[model samples]
Target chain A: MIAILNAYRYRMLIPVNRTTRVLAGLTAALLLALVWAAASGALGISLWEVLRGQEDPFSVQVWWQLRLPRLLLGVAVGAMLAGSGAAMQGLFRNPLADPTLLGLASGAGLFVALWIVFFQDSGAGSLYGQFAAGFLGALCVCLIVFGIAKRQGGGSAAVMTLLLAGLAINTLAGAGGGVLAFIASDEQLRQLSLWGMGTLTNALWRTTALALVLIAAALWLLMRSARELDLLQLGEATAHAAGLDASRLKHRVVVATSLGVGLCVALTGVIGFLGLLVPHCLRLWLGPSHRLLLPASMLGGALLLVVADTLARTIAAPAEIPVGLLTSLLGGPYFLYLLMRRNRAC
Target chain B: MLTLHQAGLTNTPAIAPLDGTIRPGELLAIVGPNGAGKSTLLSMLSGFRSAEQGELHLDGKPLRAWPITELANRRALVAQQELPGFDWQTNELLSLGSNPSKSLVAALLDDLDITHLAKRSVLSLSGGERQRVMIARGACQLLSRCSPTAKEGGILLLDEPTSALDIGQQQRLMRQLRSWATQHHMAIVCVLHDLNLASTYADRVWLLHQGQRIDHGLPNQVLNPATIAKIYAAELQRIEGGTHGKPLLALAP
Candidate 1:
């Protein structure tokens, strides 16, 4: 009976090998991060109190309303950003592809800044507007990058063009944001800067709910194409020869990535390094198969962001550093380390 | 059966109007000098590139009419040397070629004499070993395309299957391919640069030059001294007898 089951398992495209172990480890880490984030805020609430169903007003307000929403939003935003990052990396067949690197964050940032500076007075402050405009901006940048890359043909040439276009778009968006910053009032400037730094301070229940839905949908799309993504890493011609519809896969991954990153930025501002850091480091640990990598990155990203946000809130108690700033601080050094290690290996 | 009825790609640099029919249980070896449309012909035959002016049919159905998934199952192409983007076990890599059963994949690995390397990352394999693995992968694709009971024969398309192999390895691979062609009753078209190997192994040879078919016949008839001299622009001393009763041709000093 056991042998028969093993035979069945072995035939599965994404087999059960090492997946359970990885999932278990990530789940443990996630639970730990969740408990830590929920309990260690400015208004301290123990996990025990929350577990025992505390009904005190302060505990309810702090734990359920504030801390819980923030933690869950961080989880959704991180998962979306990192899951999209993994898909982008697979689509481009490059290790350096991240939402921030591809101008999704910058484009969304520019739109959000535009709204904050120009449209805030005209009732554009709603959560729906923020998600709609920001996601649209991200989707536009992603599709434009994809369009330019497609024109360049396949393989490393397309990936190179996509990266260059990303850099150009990011620079243009940054300049636009700079101009917006220059003309804004002090209050507007502060708000814009805080948003730029990346924070989950705006993790209200309504926005979190929308982010969860969008993130879940995007992740589903990415997961559905996991096998195709794996084939794509063999190079576009190779993938096509292997019977994958390469163009269709690219379209799906691009659309999913944009929706994911767009909503992520809208919810938590432009959180930078989680996308790049999570997938790159995980690829080294787990190898490069997207079936495992995509789902694993989602869980891992959620865990990392929750921990990072916990640190952001607690390290300087009563004074919160934007979670984005904390992530950049952690992610920047790691990126450099990876670069040096890769250089040495090469 | 695969037939190319005036199937041609005139705009393509290396291939002109190609016409041929490759039937099951036959082995056709394509030989040409560099930039002589060998790979291009194989590409069209494998349905990677569509014929510009004419039609290509497999089992009397136009190549384009076949769904990609079904076509992929029936035809597998092993292109020039490819380096995977990540480290994959040899077996895992082969599985990506087609959805073959695990037992079948293991058998293929054993048949290709790469069973020992199955657990190793493909990145770590030598070029010759990688080539063998690639051929095995293609074979697995053909195997997966057929049911155990029905056994629908398929075609194996290979671009320079032995380019990196040592002489002994090359002979072993050729013998293995021959056995596969006969046993599975699958059509095999291989692009080869070495004339001697083609002469020794190919049941029929197709010689091409300047985007045109120079000759197509049994190896001895097509790879004659006069045709070699004219197409290759080199003089060669043609020896009388070789292994398998084929003539041996060596470059004249």
Candidate 2:
């Protein structure tokens, strides 16, 4: 008991394991790849050579200042979104469930549209303002989803009610964003469109710091309740008989995972589907034990995002395609494949 | 070693519920038609549902005070429906029954003649095979880590152990379970639909009528044609001199 407490106090936030070994290895390779791409400006050289002076006076100022921060931002956002997706899938017992379920992405997207209209210079260039609006938007959507679902029963805790609530909120937010987009100018339109697609081009230190702290705390809270998650999959009555406070466990997980997701959405306007895709693949590899699955999911999601993000940047040289586009383009067909497979099996 | 003191489970709270006690090593069979609260009574006693009016005790201590692991270790309940999405191999499913403190589950599977199914996926098994696996799981729960002799006690709560098995398989499995109970001195509370099976297998029977337990006694006394009719709302034909002839129940048109 003493040793456990000591380990909790002193251990590295991310524990090293076979899963983590692969994660760290991939992270190193991706980080190196990202740094190399930025330094060399491997595609269109003139467009990005403005901020590379951190390492040496002669080095291009754009490489160190602009590209490195964006890379880190992608890494952080990917991990958080993936973690959120993992939690959502586990909670719903549906492989297709994602961070977008509670309307966080649409909510964040709406706020970015409204922010771009109201605030001057509120794109990737001025990230804190955008992140704040995004967080508040997600937070507000969560409250609404919670209120609507809890009144009916409880969102995401009871699978059907949660799924319905997600669908309802997602539709409402999408409609609201469409109306907002119709009213804006060409510049606002362009900014809103890119934000809707999501990017990690503007990760400032303070706001990214917020995401790191909030997400780590959230993941920690969720990880502590992994055993309860295992018992819960057995069903509520069984979980209760097994001496778990089922309602409490469900609420805790929702908060931890949702908050982690909210922070990620705030950082990178609205990344889609990593959470759903990563956990589903991980569950097939690791069994349903949350203690094993959650950590493995985090690494798997991060690796998937790294590979996807690398492709996103490299696929189109001069103009970087939004990472969310890659996820949507890739994820939808894969999701369809899984759905058909499950239907056939059933 | 189970006692439910004036326990009440009411669809409407005004109705008075039944009270009962099941002693250690006693095979108590609960018999009633559909919706007699037979399953409800079993569920309450097994800690599936909370009792409103009275307390549930295991060996004189309150049932609520026991931790989940300890409670699970002591009472092994086979629920009514088949639990789906079980991806375990047959032996692994049986091993789940083993308490962490006990020996491996191989002994029970060996005794039950399920050793050949050790590597087979439990989900792919037939109904009779599945029922046997469920029983094997409950049996393994009794002896997982330590070599628990038949003397070391535990409780076996079966809602309908032989409900799906053929006559021969049902008789074989119940006989094995009865022998295990006799050797171990553990309480066995089984909810049974078969009157003849109860008469032949159970030491005592608890008969319920419309959510009320009307009688609970030795099988011969409880299996009377009139009492059976009162609970089942049908006339029963009593046969004499059959295989282990007790009482054969026939539905009257």
Best by DockQ: 1
Ten contiguous residues with the weakest lDDT in model 2 chain A: A45-54
User: Which number leads on lDDT?
Assistant: 1
lDDT minimum window of 10 residues, candidate 1 chain A: A119-128
Q: What are the models' TM-scores?
A: 0.91, 0.79
Q: What digit string (tens of lDDT, one per residue) describes model 2 on residues A1-346?
A: 9999888866655556665565556567666655555544333444234443234433444544555566666666677777767765665545666777567777776776677777747455566666567666777776665565547642334555666677787888788888878988888888777666777755666566667777778778877876666555434443444445666776787677656665676566677778778777777765555666777676666666766776777777666777888887777788779869967986
Superposed Cα RMSD, model 2: 6.2
DockQ of 1: 0.46
Please report how far candidate 2 places residue A195 from its true position, in Å: 2.8
DockQ of candidate 2 (2 decimals): 0.20
Model 1 clash pairs are: none
If you assessed candidate 1 against the hidden native complex, which CAPRI class would it receive?
acceptable
